[model samples]
Target: MTSAPVDQQDSLAAWLSIRTTVPWPRWSGERAAAGPPAADGVRDYFTATRGDRDPEGTARVLTALDRALADAQEGRQLNFALLTGWQRYVLHRDPVGFRTLPAFAKGGRERYGLAADTAARFEQCLSQSTQPDLPLPSRAARTYLDVLFFHPFEDGNARAAMLALAFVLACDGACLDQAHPLQVTRWADDADGAADLAVLIGILISATQRRQRHRSPA
Candidate 1:
């Protein structure tokens, strides 16, 4: 029999429901000690908690993320240098940056990503999203979705996307309580996937705001 269908909206809705009900994970001592949550503080917490998950690459991605956030906060546009720098760190010794060859995901469930030549155009779209016209939550959510669909890097695109989303939030003077929601599996072809993610993003934004309020001293 053919594989059962995936209900993209239902899947995201359920995930969002459960996530919002739970307590946001406790902040690490490093994060708590950072005075106020910022991009570097988030990186510090992420690196401390998660560094061992990919011992060889965590430092690099963390460093690159800090750099990218610094630039993005100044209204700088994303370009090849920023991305390749991140890839170099995430991939370590691997020479590949953007996949010149085709890429696949989860056994090739979705269609191929944009053509290699469209990478510049992809960067343009990403940059445009950061304009003040768009809400930060929408920009962050859309950036995460863009990274999911663009598949910009050969490896570690998911991680990169998480960082990208976090950066967008941090740049807007907010920090997510957790980045785990973006780590869930996704399919580019799902019609409701992008919209659902936007909903999740809004939930995350509100959750983070509450978290900040609760954590702050009176």
Candidate 2:
């Protein structure tokens, strides 16, 4: 809930959480790279998992994620589980790909100086679930909820945060509007939490509702 426009000028902390062109995801060599025209490893992974969406398979995949989260919260190693979840979900449903959180790059530098607060904000988000009384954005926008509380990675903190929100939206029947490159660039320019969270949430919600209205019922 706590919806409202982001403080573009003051949101430096928010801006510091994302990634740039150099020194990509931490998993690049171990897995694949992040960004457009992904690495060969990424293409190969996608090729391997590409298949029809088996509802059962999807359910199992989701169950695995739940298990992974539980294990993580209980002090178990969950990097594999989280990475696997994103990979398999990408195979089962393209929509899920929008929620992917890139691994951290080395030398955690901050263009926006948010390192001190990333964990704090993430913890704050985890404490508050999206309650009925708390209006939310579209499903897609909300799906990234996982990354917010999970703190699954260190470098791509912002991506993780948004991904967490996107995940929440998807699961709650709200539509998600993957951030537009233009919008991202603009926000990047701010390099501050200057962006308005509430405004973005509202936009995502409205866009998703409009799209859902026209789709035939499943």
Best by TM-score: 1
TM-score of 1: 0.70
- The lDDT for every candidate, in the order shown, is 0.59, 0.35
Candidate 2 C-alpha lDDT tens digits along 33-124: 12212112212222233325444543544443344334434543223234435444433433232222222221222122235445455444
- Model 2 C-alpha RMSD vs. true structure (Å) is 15.1
Among all candidates shown, the one with the greatest lDDT: 1
Worst 10 residues of 2 by lDDT: 24-33
Q: Per-residue lDDT for 135-162 in model 1, tens only?
A: 5665676677667666767677777777
lDDT of model 1 at position 191 = 40
Worst 10 residues of 1 by lDDT: 23-32
Error of 2 at 199 (Å): 1.5
For model 1, state the Cα shift of residue 209 in Å.
1.9
